[model samples]
Structures are given as C-alpha cells and as structure tokens.
Target: MTARALATTCAATACAATALSLLLTSCGIIPGLGGGDAPAEDPAPSAAPDAAAAHRELPLTRQGRMFIDGGGDVLLEITFRKLQHNGEYLMIEVDHDLLEPLRASGTSTDRTAPIRLLDPVTGEVLRAIKDPGTGLSLGTYFTEGSDVTPVHQGIPTTFRRYFPAPSHDAGHLTFTGSGLGHVPGLPVEYVDEFTPSPEPNIHDYFNEYAEKTADELPGELFYPEEVPEPGLDASAFRQGIESFVDTAESSTTRSGDRETISLHADRMFDVNADEPTAEAAETIRRTALTLRENPGPGEITVVGHTDGSGSDAHNRELSLRRAEAVRDLLAEELGEDFTLTAEGRGSEEPVAEEGGEDDEQARARNRRVEFVFTVPDTAAGAGGEGLDSAARHVAAPAVFFEDLEPVATAEHGDVELNVYPLVRDGAYLFQMVGFGNSTLSDLEADLGAGEEVAGGPDRVTEGTLGGFRLLEPDGPTRYVVRLVTEDGYEDFADEVLTLSPGDEYLALAVFPAPGPDVASMTLHAGAFGEIPDVPIR
Candidate 1:
C-alpha cells in the first residue's frame, strides 16, 4: 500500500528468481517460511517446568516401531525418540515424518498412536494403556462419527505418558512391540542423563497455513491440498460418565443340596496378587453381616477354587492364597467368636460347563471363594436347613461386563444406541453399548477407535489398544482402552463399526477417569446430543 515499497517490490519482481521470488520470506517477518539454524520455541507449555523440577530423563532404550494405529496399517520407518521420566511417569517424543518417504502429502488425516512396552528378556504383556483423550473434538459435527481430525501427518504430537515405567532399576528394560515393526528389536541406546535441548519443531499443517496478510503464496504452499474423505458420522462416540450407581447385582448363584456362596476371586484381587482390592471391602462387609445372622456357630468353610487353564501346581497355589485371604477377612471380622477353616481345591468342583475353558466368563466360575455352611446335628432338623437367600453373594463380574443396563438412551439419524457406563475401577471407567441401525444405507458408527482414514499401506503392527494413554487420577493408574485380548474382549480403539441397514452391533468405549472428586462427566459424541449424569458404579 506504500508507494515507495510498491516501486521497490515491482523492481524486485523483475528479478524475482534471483532475490525475492520464493526465498525472501524466510525471516520471522513471516514465521515458518524458510529453514533456519535458530533454535525453535517450545510449542508445548507443559514442558516448561522450573529447572529445580524433579523431572528425570529416561531413554526409550529401543527403537520404537511406528504404526499408524499400533498395527501395521502403515509402518512409518521412523526413528526412536527419547523419553523423560518422573517417578513412575514417562514422557516420550518421536520424530514426526523426518524422512521424506513418510511425509504427509494429499490430504490431512488424524491418527491414534498405540504403544506397548515389553520385557526385553521375556516379552510378556504387563499392561495396556488406552487413548485417554475422549476422541471427541469440542467443535463441529464433521468430526463426530469419525474420531479422525485434521492433522499434519509430518508433525510430531509428542505422545505423553504412553505407559508408566515398571520400576526404578528395571534396566536392560527392553521395550519391544509387534505393531508395524517389520524389523525385530528397535536399536537401544543408553544415555546417562536426559538433557533436553530444544530442537527445530516442524510447523504442522495448521500452523503452516499460508496467510493473505503477507501476500504470500496460497494455502497449498504449506497446508495439504485435499481434505480427507469423510467416513461415518463420529458424533456418537461417548465422552465421560456423569454419575454412577450399581443397577445390576455384582453376582448371582444357583442353589444345590448345600447353600454355597461363591465370591469371584479375580475382582477381589489384582492379577496374581493375594490382597483384596479396595472395592472388595464392600463385599466383605456384606458377607460378614450375612454370616453373623446365621443361627448358632455353624461350621463355616472358606474354600478357594481355580480354573483348569493353569498348571496344577500354579492353580493350587493360587487357590490357597485366595483362601488365606478370605480367612484373614473372617478372622478380622468375627475375632474368636466363630470357627472358620480355609481350604484350597484347585481346578476341582468347577460350576461352569466350560469351567476348564480359557474363556474369562467360563473361567470366572472357577476363580471363586466359596462359603459353605454346615449345621450341627444337635439341633432338630438342623441338617435340613440350608443357606438363606442372604447367604448367596451378588456381584457383577469386575473386569468383564455383560448385559449391563443402559444408563441413558440416544439415537442419531438411524443409529439407536443404549449406553452402559458399567463400572469404574481404579483408573478408568468401562462402558458397553449396543447399536441398532434400521436405515437402508450403510451406517458407520465411530466407536472412537482406530484411524478414520488409512495413512499408508506398507505397515502393520498391533494397532489395537494393547497399549496407550495412561489416566492417573488420584487412585490407581488405569489405561483408557488398554486391553489384552482375552476370550471375546478387545480394545475399543481397534474397531470401526459398519452397520448395514437393519443391522445391529455392540461396542465398548473406555475413557479416562474424571478423578475421584468428580462423580460424573457428560458423554459427548461428534454432532449428536450429549448424555449427562451417566452413572459410574
């Protein structure tokens, strides 16, 4: 607009290629127009902590195989980024499309990075972390049914808290994974300390957008020329739970000649651990009350049983540990007033038709603690009396849930949904939902899992939520949808529901805990309405 500057620009255009054509825009006069040696500013404010902060640095010690969604959908020949640690927490950073072959071209796409850490020596799956982010954008309906959002495929997202470090001295800690890892063993490097130096952050598509203010090149010069093809309406993915209550009984039992109350041992304790979980306290209290109401000090037997899957020795030991746990509870509750005996009978007296099956539900029947009541022969017809209804304990399966009632009902277009905010464990809340589609057209329900659009065709690793974001509330550390495929269960992130007309299906959505102080959170899907006060059991 200035006369003198206009004349100078006109003269420069005459020799544009020599001086001003596509090179002069390199200065900060227009950010991200050219390459530079200057150190870049930190894009994330969270990374800025006081130097005195106790954050420690840790190396991934292995090249992390990059998959599009933890699967080999697109194996990005990527370099393993470094990791920083604080206590059991970890922060990992990876190169974003540093290689020309992996750069984003045509259209911008969204991606969910699924990560897993395995023991170098034994490669056992210790835990699973899910996408803690609700996978719901706060904006428009366009991103609703599709958890995919516009993102520069070439820009690094600095995936935070992929999984917590197992322990402090857990060294030679090999982090191996299957997803998209065409090659075995990511090269591990040992670093003495984590000294983070700011590197040049490649501006992503959004930040690289061209502007008209500088009379710069059109948007295509930076941003992707095309937009991703829209798939399903992702607006139906649930976000968070608002309130919680137990609508279904935790358990149910069948009657026999003798009244036996079987408590699922799995829910009371963690994997292979003997102590009862905090939630199990409620069940123990109820059990004590029922026992107190029984007439006379009848002989009470606490018997622990196990499924036929594990070795006889291992199963027997597990059963005994569980029996001791129950006996301890009784000893604490009744003191010396009651005669209690604890016993372990492994893989014997299974109640399930497939109690020997590896299936969790079938195995659940055998993974139990039974309370057997025997009356004294002195009382008239005492042997004839069986356990009352109160003697049977009720509890829904802890980790696995089935036929949970919908706390709220919702429908979008032809998608009828019944949402079950089933229960909350230490770190995450489990949700089960049923979807029925009655329309003639094929409907896609964005269950908030996987990449909406394909990135590349060359890579495939375990893209499922076998490992993901960690949701550390005030309680226990929980994964978003971290699932180790057992029986019929899989992580929620690895699925995309495609329903033809008159078709129906069920889905699971795992979200981060809203913290203990907050009892409820509203569940939101893309463009559809929100479901509030969805209870947590």
Candidate 2:
C-alpha cells in the first residue's frame, strides 16, 4: 500500500481500542477478558463433518502482545475477536476501524475488518479462493514457518505487532499465536489500533507570549548646568582704562597725519549691525571711488571681531555678520569687481582686556572692524623670484656593480660582491644585470660534484643574468652585492647573500616584471649544489 494509506490505516487502528472501550462501557459490557480467567475446553469432536466444521468455525476471541525482529524493531499489544471462519481457517476482527475510504462510493459503514488466517499453529500462509471472473475471495489461509512460535500457549494469547502510524497517533495491538492450536510451531499474529492528535499552530503561541511580557518600564529627564558668575579685577580694570586712553590719543594723531577722519560715539552702530554701519558704508564708498579713479594691483582684507560678553558661538556669528556687512558695502560700491577677502576673529586676539564691570566698553573695543591692504610683489620691489634659484638638480644614475665583475668566486664563510652604479656626464647608464650564488658542498653531496655557477638571459626582462661562483669547500661561504641607481633615479638590491660550506648556491637580486610597467621590480633566488649541515642563520 502507499505510505499515506498505510499511515491512515494505522491511525484508524489506534483509535479503535479507545472507541471500543467507550462503547462497551456505555453498554455496561466488559471489553477485555478477565484477568486469571481460563477458557473452558471444548468437548470431543463429533463424527459428522458438518458438526466438526461448525465447532471449528466457532467465533473466537483473543488478547495478545506482538513482537517483530529484523523486519522492524517494534511491538504492539491488542485485544480482538475471532469472528467467523470457513473450514479450517479462522477470521479475526479487531475492535477499531482498520480501513479508510475503502469504497469510492463514500457511503460505507465504519466496521471492524477481518484478519484472515490459514491455521492457528502450523504458521502457514493461507491463500484466498476466488472466482476467476469475479475476482472475489472465498476464504484465506495462514502460512507455516519454523520462525513462528507461540507468544503464549494453552491460555488465550496476547498478540502484538508494530505498524507505521501517523505523526501524532496513539494505539494498541492484538494478534493470535501458535498456542491457538491451528499451527503447531507458529508465532503470534498481531493487530493495532491507532489515533492521531490534532496538529499545533506555533504563531498564535508566540504573539500571545509577547503581548503579556511587554507591560512593565519607565521614562527619562534632562537638565542643563547654570552659567558661571562673572568676576572683576580692580587692577586689570584700571590698566584697561589706561590702555584705552592711550589708544585714543594715538588714533587721533595717526588720523591727523594721514589726513583721515575719526569718530567717537556712545554706541558704535545701530542695534542690528548685520547691514553696514554708517561709517563703514561711507569708508567702503570712498575707498571704492578712489580705486575706480586709480585702479592698480592691490587687495583689501576686512577684519571682523566680537565682544567677550557673549558665548563663543554667539560671538563667532556676530563677528561673521560684521565682516559680511563690510563686504556688502564694498561690493555694492565697487560694483562686485573688487577682489576683497574678509575674516572674523570672534573675541580672540583682543586689544583691551575687559574687567567684567566695563562690559560695555570691552564690547565696544571688541566690536570694532578694520581694513588692511596688500600691494602686489612687483610694487613691493621683490620681483617674485623667491627660492627658484636655490633649488637642487636631480642626481645622475650609477651602476651598482663596479668592484664585482659579471662573474666571481668565493670560498666558504664570507664572499662579498661589491656593487656600484655607473654614471656618465650627468646621465646614469646600465641598471644592475643580476646576482645569485650556489653552494659547492651541496653539489658534492647531491651530484657528487663541487659548486658550479650558471648564467643565462633573465626570464622576465630578457636582460643578461649572472651570479658569483664558489668551488667545493668544507665550511660556509657567502656573496654580497649592492645595486646603484641609474641616472637620477633611486635604486636598491637584495640586502645580503650567504652560502654554507659544502655544496650550495643562492641568487638574490631585483628584476623587472614580465610585462610592461618596467617601473615595477621583484627579487628572485634559488639554492643549488650540496647544502652544508650548518644552520640557515
């Protein structure tokens, strides 16, 4: 049968036992055989076949436990009724409904299904005799086998069998064993009653839990600190007053000598100086008129400042506004073509220190603005040739290998390769070719030969590749070379090269990349000949 059909069948079987219990309890009838009660033996058989057949076909009831071995390791214990039979076979019916939608007609009654058998003891399979045309079964027989044995003998046997059931099903099982007298050495047969529990929904549980847990927390508050009280210094206060008086006298003299006008006032400007102050406006107009009358290479810078009475942020904004006011006046008078820059130094670099009590006077000095002029270098007599003559020229390139030839030799221990770049007339020539070394001990040990040196074309740049050579020796030997820059370019080579005694070699040098972008470099090396037992250090 299909898996789904088998599962449904098992589910129905499990529910059958419970349904039977309820039904029997409702009818005031006992559903199971009483404990410690034995069935009475039948009288000796009669001679007539009809009488014997009647006796053998009598309805039988049994309760049994079931067991499965290799087929599947599961058990089922059940109680069932051996309903009716034909000839030597017995037909047993379970308490639960074992079939599901057996008839497509969908109107069949829910009834206990029959488990047909051949013989109760011999453990032989029974085949149903059916009409050739109708394909209807006459009766069924039980199969015989040695593997079958009685779960219980003499007394009514408890039948147990394990069957696949739906995921949430529950049930019990029942079957007959060889002790039923039909089969001599057969095992018990089984029946199962299964019922499935309703499936659970997860989302509903989660939402309910979340809502219950969300009802228990508090709020937040914030308060700012108070501003510090202002302090006054008597000595500093006197000094500031004196300084102001001195500045006023100096200003008067400077204004007179330069033929400029000056103004002293209780208030520098109107409440909102965002727009140009009258004096600033007049000054910007006069400056622009003068520039128009005599245009030349000169620039004007408008410096802005603010009082220390306010916070830094507020003072900065006020300073910027004051500078912008002057700029607007100049721009409007000069027709936007004038090259002018404005800067604000809010409460910084103060000319007069305020003593807190003279806050107004301190603010008056800080709030003032001024204009500075810068003449072009040509007019300043510098002629603009600053630092150009003192610059250094680029150095020429030099060949790194000068003392060391294309090929050289060294014994064990220290072999030094002297390398220097070649420079001609201010131009550098010939980048270092290549450098490498081999061990004599390695060759002698591995190839049974002393150290040997090999030179060939560079695989990357196709340039000539060469290195030092050392003959067989007992101890360690090494070779070193330094690369020199070509022309005005900087150059470098591998730091050092060392070779152990015996047979071994090493090649270390900078080479160009395989493709274009010759500016790129890389190092290459290898060991050959026999390596000595000395440590790599």
How do the residues 1-537 of candidate 2 rate in per-residue lDDT, one tens digit apiece?
A: 001100011111111111111111111100122222233432212110121211112123322111111111111223343332222222333222211121111111112111212121111112222223333222110111111111111112211121121111111111212111011111223233222211322212322332331122011111111111122111110000000001220111011001111122113356535665556455455545544432242455666676666788876777777777776777777775667777777788454456656555555655555544432211111101211111111111111110112222223323322221211101011122222224333111121111221111111111111222111132112111112112221111111212223212211222111111111111112222222221100
Winner by TM-score: 1
Which has the greatest lDDT?
1
Q: What ranges in model 1 sit over 4 Å off?
A: 1-75, 84-88, 98-113, 120-163, 174-178, 181-193, 199-537
Q: Which stretches of model 2 miss by more than 4 angstroms?
A: 1-268, 277-280, 287-297, 356-359, 376-537
| 10 residues in a row with least lDDT, candidate 1 | 22-31
